[model samples]
Each structure stands twice: as C-alpha cells, then as structure tokens.
Target: MVYAPIHESLPGPISPSDRIESIDALRGVALLGVLAINLVTEFRVSIFQHFLPAALPASSLDRAVETVLMLAVDMKAFALFSLLFGVGLAIQFEHLAANSRRALLLFRRLLVLLIFGLIHLCLIWNGDILTAYAIAGLVVLPFLFGPRWLLLAGAAAFLGLYLTMQVWSPPGLFPSLASIQSNVEEANRVYATGNFGEVLAFRLREIALILPLHIYVFPRTLGLFLLGAFVWRSGVLQKPNHVLLFTAGAGCVGLGAAMILLRAGNAMAGTSFGVLATPAGTILLALGYGAIIIAIASSARGNALLGWAAPLGRMAFTNYLAQSVIFGWIFYGYGLGLFGHLGAAEALAIGLVVYVAQVIFSGWWLGRHRYGPVEWLWRTLMYGTPQPLLRAGLNDSGQRAA
Candidate 1:
C-alpha cells in the first residue's frame, strides 16, 4: 500500500497551517543546543580529552561545564534535527500525488543541499552536518513508503548494530595520547595561521577522520530518520495524543537518568560508554523535547514567548550557514585568528550572543521576505526557477506572514 496523505491521516497539528510555528520553535531550540555542543570543536579542543579530565588536567569548573554539556546538549540536538528532517520529508510527500514526481523533487532538493554542504565543508567549516543529512536523505527516500512496522524494525536493527559496535570495540581502539595531542596541535597550527589552501587541506584531513566513523554514524542517522517518519505517520505529532506524549516524556526522563548514571560510572572507572548510551538517551530526549514544544506552542501563553523561535526556525538554513561563516571569521586565521584561544565557557557565551542576534535578525528579515536568503536560493535551485523573496502583505502564503 502507498503512504497515505498526512492531511488525511493526521489532520490536526500536522495541518500545513499550524505545523510551521511549532516545528520551527523546536528546530530553533535544537539549533541553539547544537551551537552549544559545537564549541569544543570550534575551539580546537579534543572532545575525548575534555571528557576524560585526566587526559587534559581540566579545572573543576571546566569539568563541571563539560559534564553539563555531555549530559544535556551533545547528541540530543542532532537527533532532534534528524527527526525533524524526516518529518519534513513526510510533509512533502503528503502534498504530492505521484510517487515518481515526489521522488524527483526530493532528489533535486537533496542535490541542492549536497552542493551547499560541499561548499560549506570545503570553504567554511569542516563540522558540516548538511552533507551527511543530504546523503542520508537519499538513502532514506525509498523507505518512506514502507509500513510503520517495517520502519520501526529498521530503526531498531540499525541502532542495535551501532550499539554492538560500540560495546564490542576494544579499548585499545582509542586514540593514543600522543596522537590526540599531535592532531590538536596540527589543527590549531593550520587553522590559526594557515592560508586558504592550507585550511582546505586541513579540512580534507578532517573529512577523512569522519569517513571511518560514518559506518556507525550513518546507520544511526538512518535509524533516526526512519523513526521520525514513523512518528509522523502515526499522527502523534499531528494531535495531542497524551498516551504518546506521556510515553515519550517518560522514556526521555528514564533514559536521561540512565545516561547520567552511565556517565558518572564511566568517569569513575576511566572508561567511556557514551558511544552507545548517549545516542539512545538523546533519541528519547529529542522525541520528548519535540512533543513538549508542540504542546507548549499549542497554548496561548506559551506561544507568546516561544513564538519568537518560529522565525529563527523558518530561517534555520540561513542561520546554520551564517553560524559557520561568523564563527569561522571569529576563530580562523584568515579572519580573526582566534583559534584555540577561547575556553569552552567563553566560546559558549559567544555562541549564545550570536544566536540571539540571529533570532532578532531573522524575525526582521522574514517580516518583509518570504524566506531567508540562503533558503530562497536553495528552493530556487531545487525548483529550477526563481521564487518570490518578498512578502506581499499579511495575507502572504508563506508561514512567516501567518
């Protein structure tokens, strides 16, 4: 059987009209969390070393900060983003009558995203998720029409394989102290003083490092995508299904507590179980976060405050790229040459300030425009035609106007 139209099967919250505000608010939250966790990489700090305080001789305050980040922000944000990506795909599918046309459109959209991602990776930042998402999107497209049971099974199987790899891998696989230090030094040297070519070379090396980990990461991402599609198809996000909401919220709290316990024990034992536990915990937490955000946005009082995030979410593509450009300028040699100078706390503070500015700017821009500049460009390329960037009036069809 073909996938049913979302509007028919889940006609409440997932309705096109009301969907944008809540989803955008949740996305905005995820963006902030991603920025917070990305500070370690931006500062050229070894994440492993930061977590294992003995490796780096971190201060108590630093360790405390890292603990908070690890337990809260790290994997959860990306999971939220991935889930949202799947929801978006399902939403698109709901509007298309012909599967062939839908597939073609999705392929073009992903192709445009891939091009943007490659540009960002090569010239801007190496920690690009867009490329990976685009790649995963292509893989996930065929499965969109699969039954919910099949999707759930696929998610479970892939997640199981990822966890098995994490648990079965020998501790000796961990990078040596010398290797970590050398890599850190090399990254700092290249990013702090290198020319454009040198920076590109370093980025290539970084991409190489990502290649090996994709074995686990790619499958995990696919699993999350399938799970997200399943969630959307099930109508949980479309309506106030208290049973699903309670289940997800309970799962999040339970998994979060378990993650904290695992981390504490790992810290004491000088081992890392986060590779396996963090993903599971974060997935649950991401679902819970999405459900809670939708619930809040549905309310009048909550909307007054959280509605601000919708604008940021609408411009997520633009803000995502802007973060890389602005942060690159702040840290890279070609700009401010401040690489490795700021500590985690300082970097986090700066990221927050930048995000706030983006919120204000995005709201102002969307007030007069149909889409963010980059988003407009992406849609133009995807659709093979120019789109209207200007909002005509309060009756404009774009969600920003609504």
Candidate 2:
C-alpha cells in the first residue's frame, strides 16, 4: 500500500498526491527500534554495563546475542524518529505555504507540541524531546527558505560547533566535580533506595538544565530532515525499486555492524565514541529501514508484522504515550518495580511481548474505531471542532453527521 502525508498538498499535483509509503514503513520499524533502545533508558538501566554485558559475562553465546541486538537495534531507531519528526514539519510547512498561512499555523503547531512535551516531561518522563524539537524547529525556520547549499553548510557548522563543545567546554558550563559526583550519587540513591517521586525530582532537575544539547544537536536532526525532504521530492518513496530497496538493506546491515564494533571497542577502552557515533549510524540505518519498508510496499506483500506496524504508525503519538504507560507499569515502583532489575535481553523479550500485544490491540481497535484516540483529540484541538470518534462515511476529518 502507498503512504501519503495526512494533509493534502495544495499547489502540488492533485491527481496522484504525495504517497509517503517509505516513511510509514520506516516509522513502523523505528517504533520497534525505539522500544529496543528506550526500554533500558526508561527503566534507568545501562543497557551495556548493567544489562547485556553483565548478563552475558564470558559466554560466547550471550556475546553473540548481544552483538546481534546492538548492531541491529540500538541507538538508531530514535534518530530515525527524530528525522521523521522533521519530515512531518516539512510536510506541514509545505501545506502551510500552499495556503499562505505558514507563520501562524506553524507557530501554533510548535506551541502545541511544546505543551504536549511539557506535560509528558513533567508527568511521565524527563527525557521528552518534543519541547527541544519544537524549539530547534523555530531556530531552523528562517533557514527553511534558504538554498540547499546554505542549509547543508548551516547544518555542518552546527554539528561542528556541537562536537567542539563535547570535547571542550566554556568556563562555568562544565559541572563541578562535586556537582557531577552529587548527581551520580543521587541517581544511585534513587535507584537503590528512593521512591518514584524522588527519582522524578532528581531527573527533572537535570533535564531542565540541558538546553544546549538540544540546541547544538540541531545540525544532525535538521540535516536528516532536509535529507528526508529531498527524498520526498525525489520520489524514492514512490519508486521503491529493487536497487533502492537493496541499497537500503545493505546500508542498514553495514552501518549497523560498524556501530556494534565501535560499541565493543568503546567498552574495552572505556571510551564514549559510541555515543558520538550513534547519530551518524542512525541516519544510515534509517535509510536501510526505508529500503525495507519500500520492499514491503512494492512487493504488495502483507504480513501480521506490517499490519500491526501500520496501526502504531498511524497513531504514533498515542502509541508513544502508551509505551510510557505500559513501561512505567512494568518498571516503576507504582507497578512491578522491576526497574534496575531486568537485563537487556530480558528487557527486549518483554518489549517484544508488549509489542505483540499492542499490535493485536491496535489492529482491533482501528478496525472498529475511526481514529486512534489521541489522533482524534489532536485533530479536534487543531481545527477547534469536536471530531466524531466513530466512522460514519464522513470526510477523513470525522465531521460527517449521522
């Protein structure tokens, strides 16, 4: 099946329209990848140090499993998600431009995203990227009308400055040794002895202060977004031929393998190159993911996996929130209290279980319902009208009356 942006292009071709199949498929794959990487972070466990590596020890068997997962699933998924977010912005901008209402509409959307992000951060988790993305998006807005070369140069400059900051620091920006130790000690205390409120409070303080990382990290995200826009313009998603699909698969495998090797080296040498390398690797792997999706779309093949994946992609915001809720129950003191207790492999196993359940649940829910719950709510807020929740032959906006 073909995928298109939710909103139609105004000035662009009206016949075929923009079918962004590659993005949908990529999004589905990325959602799963998100669970792969985020489960550890959300549970407050170090996937490498405390989970996978510790769980494995000297066993070649465990090492084998760890190697496969690290290469195939870790770190890359979130980058893909971020890139897609930028693509969504580009699509929205395209529509706004078509209607000559970009300034107000875009600002409204970003404000809403920031509000949603704040709620998620304060109530659910401190690692929310929504506000950061909204803020960065605003910074990138003026440059959106610039030429491709300028955009590329700007992205590169931003990335270079960010890398420099990582290795060296301005005075007073670096945390004091006492402060660093206190933060680490506090984290350990929360994990070891504190309750949910204490853990939330500790993390909230750190998150509130890390604005620079969000700003400087812009180059890569903006770069990827531009790449996505280029791809959208180039008809890659529409074509989905063997060459594109094959290239993507190979790319995913190659970059994914390299990242795994780098991670292993980082572990051996007590280095952090892996963290720095992850974004680039994620970009490559996202391409690979795109290829995989294109292959599925082009072949006209259907599977339970894709069927399930489609629903999650269709209702990504809801599913994202659902992940937090489900994982919170699995890991937090409010539920099973398995935080810091589960290893990476076991965590992945549980994630898979939850994924399967979500797939069935989402598929069933969509079959009978009009939109995923949150999607309906977001649309209602956007249009300032109460949208119907059930299907009744109305427009896609759910405005048809009984």
Candidate 3:
C-alpha cells in the first residue's frame, strides 16, 4: 500500500532524510523471506527440480521446513520484491519536479540496474532477478505518464493474462521434467565441485537455456510493478488494516494450495497447477506483509519497535548483492562447496543468521554513511557525478566539511 508524500522533491538519489521509514521497514521484512527462499534455491536445491517427485524431503524436519516455506516464503518474497521495485519507480516519479523529464532519468537508473543485473547473472549468480526487473521497468516507462486508472488497469490485465497462460497449460511453454532434471544434475555437479571457470561457463550455458522462462515470467513481474505504482498514486496503502489484509492473504495461500491439490499426484504438477497457484498466493501475501509493516511504521510506538528494519531496507540493494557474494562463498564450488548438501532446515537456519547480521550491519553503517556502498555507487553512475557518502561530521565529495 502506498500513500501521498509528506515531503518535497529530489532529482538523483533519494536522501536518507527523504525516505519513508515504513517502506524501508517493509523492504527489510520482505528481504528475510527473500533470503530464505533464495537460500533454498542456492544452497539446498534447484528451483528447476521443484516439481520433481524427489523434491519432497526425506526427513520430517526438512519436510516441515519445506511446508512452511511453500506456504509463506517461496513466491511471496519475489512478489514483494517485484512490488517494491515498482513502488520505488513511482516514488521517484513523485519526487521529480512537475516539468521533469521522467523517462531519461528513469532510463539511466534502469540502465545502471541492468548492468548490475547482467554482471550478477553472468558472473555471480544464475538466479538473478535484477535483469528481469530492469527489463520490466523499461517496459513500464511509458505508463508512468499515464493516469492513475491506467496503471491499475494495466496491472490487472497483465496479471490476468499471465494467470490465464498458467491455467491454460500451453504445451512446450514449460520445460519437460527430464530436461529440467538433467540440468539440475549438471548444476549440482558443477556448482559443488567445478572450479571458477567451469562454474562460470556452466552458468552461461544455463542462462541460455532459461531464456524462454524469462519471457514467461515477465507479465507477472510487470503486473506487480504496475500494481505497486497504482497503489502509490492512489494512496490506497495509506491506512489499510494489517490484520484484515494478512488474514485475506492467508486465505489466498490456502486457496492456492487447494488449486494444486486438485491435480496432485500428477507428474511434475508444478509445470501445471503449481505454477498457476503459487503466484496468486504470492501477490496477496506480499500485499498483506506490506500493509502490516506499513501499519507498524505509521505509529510512533510501532515505528520505534520496527526501527531496526528501516536501515536494513534502506541498504537493501547492497545487502541483496552482498547475499549472493557471501553465500556463493559458503555454498559454491570455489569456496565451501556446500551446494546441494544442506537440508531445507539447515538452509533456513543459515538464512536467518545471514539476515540478522545484515540487520545489525545496516544499522551501524547507516549511522555514519548517507548511503549503502552499492547505493552510493548506483547514484554516482546514474547521475554522472559523485554523490555524498558521509554525514555532517565527515568531509567527502559533494559535501562541505563540518
């Protein structure tokens, strides 16, 4: 849910002073789920094999963890992340002067994001979303100039189209289970034991194979982006009831599960119903989580309670990339090579540890610096100048000495 700004405008980067702490807190909260789900993908198992019969955990503990993740985290985290990406664009638009050239600035910003995404996708992580987001962001650029209703309608229409495709179960749109299984087998072997060059080559090959999937998921990601923008303009998120929204989200989750069960025991059901159901629940729960966090951030007392999360959210871009780097070291072949070794339970535990450390570090870093390291770099490149990186007591480029 979004609301009208209580403040004025800026051009390049959003200053720490201009931020809505509630949204920061929401991003922080969303990152936790995101990390959990990513860990499962990165450390425990490949998402390509998610529909395989072998995906069911062998142990009760891992099974329980998988169950919780399925209902709560999986698609929900990515959905929230995508929604926030859209929200950030809308906020940037609002911050511009009335006569501002929105397209050029947004283009530069997304170009930087696309570069970051490509590096992440090709050299660092195979499951990168930044490129997909930058691509979708580019597609939504023209809509920024449209009226509020158009944003909402585009969101609904795109999402409806995506859902229809899922339910329709178009042949060959989904990769065969055998093909996916072969890829997963090779991925596990390469990521767990191959050297740097070997892993890099394998990732390149995998990216080419998954290119079609990128197209398939675009509508869902774009719809969420548009929905986020609409809410920001309409102020629909300004005062939503947290409990009610969360309850509704939980119902959606249950509804999605029921949809999958309708075709349960069918081979590779994820290729069919699982894909159809997962995203519906994801969008709703993401909204619910956002509303809950916003409500907390709105109150003086509640804001104080969730204050720690604000810094975490503010540094989300940095932390997001950092997770890939750190976890790659822990799980990939060139480092600890623990890939495909941990159970769902252990991966979840490690994810929690990583998130806590990020929370603590983000608070400490933001106390002294104006932006996270990556964010500072992003702004510098986007605006074609060095942005300030320190506070009143520190002298830096773009700042006067205290």
Predict model 3's lDDT versus the native.
0.80
Per-residue CA lDDT of candidate 1, range 1-402, in tens? Answer: 222232332111122244557778888888898888876554445333342334532466656666777776777788889888888877766655344456777789889999999998878887888989999888888887777788788878876776677667545545566666666668778888887788778877777555445555777788888888887888877665555676767777677658756765775244446655655666677777777777777567767879989889988999999998888777777878778776666777788899999999999998887678998898788766666577653232232232
Root-mean-square deviation of candidate 3: 5.2
Comparison by TM-score, 1 against 3, better one: 3
- Taking all chains together, each candidate's TM-score versus the true structure is 0.86, 0.78, 0.88
Runs in model 1 lying further than 4 Å from the true structure: 1-18, 43-59, 98-100, 169-179, 242-247, 267-275, 393-402
Of candidates 3 and 2, the better by lDDT: 3
- TM-score for candidate 1: 0.86
Q: Distance (Å) between predicted and true CA of 153, model 2?
A: 4.7
RMSD per model, one decimal: 5.9, 5.6, 5.2
CA lDDT of every candidate? 0.73, 0.62, 0.80
* Best-to-worst TM-score order: 3, 1, 2
Give the local distance difference test score of model 1.
0.73
Candidate closer to the true structure by TM-score (higher is better), 2 or 3: 3
- lDDT per residue as tens, model 2, 1-402: 233333343222111113354455567668887876677554545222332223343456545545665666665676677667766766666655656656666676677777888887777766566777777677766666666566556656665665555455566744455555555545544644556777567657766345444555655666666555555445555565767678767877587667656755675234456555555565577667666665775554633336457666766788778887788667766567777676556777888898778777777876666668876776566545565566544434323344
Question: Which is superior by lDDT, 1 or 2?
Answer: 1
* Best candidate, lDDT: 3
**For residues 1-402, what per-residue lDDT tens digits would candidate 3 score against the true structure?**
223332234445665776788888989988998898889855556667675677467689998887778776777788888888888999887766373666777789899999999999998888888999999999987798899999999999989988887777457776777888899999889989988899899889888667767777789999999999997887755555657655665575566555544434344465755666556656766776666667777678878999899999999999999999888888879999998988888888888898999999999999899999999999888877677787754333223353
* Candidate 1: pairs in clash: none
